[model samples]
Target: MGKEIDSTITFQNLSQKNMSFEQVFQHIITFMKKDPSGNFRLMFGTDSQVFNHYTKFITGIVIQQERKGVWACIRKVTVPRQMLNLHERISYETTLTEEVVSMFTKDHKEQLINIVIPHIYKGANFTIEGHIDIGSGKKNKTRVFVKEMVSRLESIGLKPKIKPESFVASSYANRFTK
Candidate 1:
């Protein structure tokens, strides 16, 4: 089992006040089941912000239906600061993402893909991808980590995305960490 991280998820369009993990899972499942013809994509990503004494990490899950926009849930956690280099920071972000994806997929594997329509393949079916907050370019300190991060994600059968394409982590989750 991976380290248990506490999370609070807000289901945008739903009227529910507070939702448990199971409830969120059910909500997503029901949403997919209700629209069997809609194209769907599930993405998971994490981003972190460092403060003088601690670091804040935010992880997000996005469920998108073709042209219908998206519904997402975010979890934020703050921990004592550690002197981590750029590589370490990116590595930690990726690890947190892996843990969240693994936890979700462990029990929801079948449910995640069972409802996809056979002919509506506009994007990935049920694959959970990781969006790292790193980019290419010699001036970017994190650039050297792109290959390593991608390989790490690939080792666990996950697709990886970096800057320019990794808006989920660099943009979406980054918003909450600040």
Candidate 2:
């Protein structure tokens, strides 16, 4: 077997203790079950902060319960700096989001549960939105790759969110990376 990648995740409201991905998923299910209305959105996003010799990557999951409230979980990892260009950084961020979504969706499919989002008139039981850090603006150099990133996400069947709308990445996760 391949060597495991060491990592830890902490839920903002749950506890500071480290948790595996499975444990995090269980918590999400419990949170969703608490409200029979089932109107909630699960959003995942990732952001990175480059230091002198290393880069810190933060991946955040935000669960919004239709204005009831919000809960978030975050995982952080650090790696030696690679001096990645803007394109590489954006690509890496998207890859991280995709990995987390893939894990959640795979399990969600096996253990099907009906999630009712009142606003969503039709389709799947729930939706996972991927918040990309790249956005269109004069100050943001990452804007150039927004279309490519969005297209990649769409090809994999994930709804993409950018800047202003992608607070999970630009706001929530960005906080911890700092």
Candidate 3:
């Protein structure tokens, strides 16, 4: 049922004009046959960015048919920090100045997360430093990467978080898949 309704609506209609990302989102929920009827949702990014770009992240959405409407949304799950860490961590170098590391140790962190993924709301947030745990698989690959990302985020006066970013990413992923 959900699939059938979704098939009838072109993704473009959900995000073609200057409608704020929220407006387009509303159209999607409404057209998809919402029971409670909520055609308005707002996110802090472009609809195209959030949607239309999930394959890049290797994620997908799964829509579960509710008794009368669609689900809240769910996506292929993974480690919040792992996902935000980005593959770039694989080639990161760990040579932070003692002063820089010390400064950060005293400050908070930011995290980068993927928001609405599969459906077309490919979202990402960068705050709360994603604690990188270089698994025993590699030498110092992950260690270096985490150090680099932290330095980069600090350079921009930002921090990293894992929870929010992960939640957003999975939510979008589920929506896109649906």
Q: Write the per-residue lDDT of candidate 3 for residues 60-154, one digit (tens) a residue.
A: 11122223333222112122333223344222211111212222222111110122222233231122222222332345443434455455545
lDDT of each: 0.74, 0.76, 0.28
Q: Kindly list the per-residue Cα lDDT of model 1 for residues 34-110, writing each as its tens digit.
A: 66667776777889988899888888777777787777777665779853677777888888888677666554767
Which stretches in model 3 have alpha-carbon errors above 4 Å?
Answer: 1-144, 163-166, 169-178
The backbone clash count of each candidate, in order, is: 0, 0, 43
Task: For candidate 1, give the lDDT.
Answer: 0.74
- Each candidate structure's TM-score, on Cα atoms with residue i matched to residue i, is 0.81, 0.82, 0.24
Worst 10 residues of 1 by lDDT: 5-14
Cα deviation at 157, candidate 3, in Å, is 2.3
Which of candidates 1 and 2 reaches a greater lDDT? 2
Q: Candidate 2, residues 1-178: lDDT per residue as tens digits?
A: 3333335434443465577776777777777767736566789899999889988888898877775787688877677985468788889888888777766654463442454544235432456688999889988898899999999888777789898899999999999988
Regions more than 4 Å wrong, model 2: 1-14, 82-84, 109-113, 117-125
Best by TM-score: 2
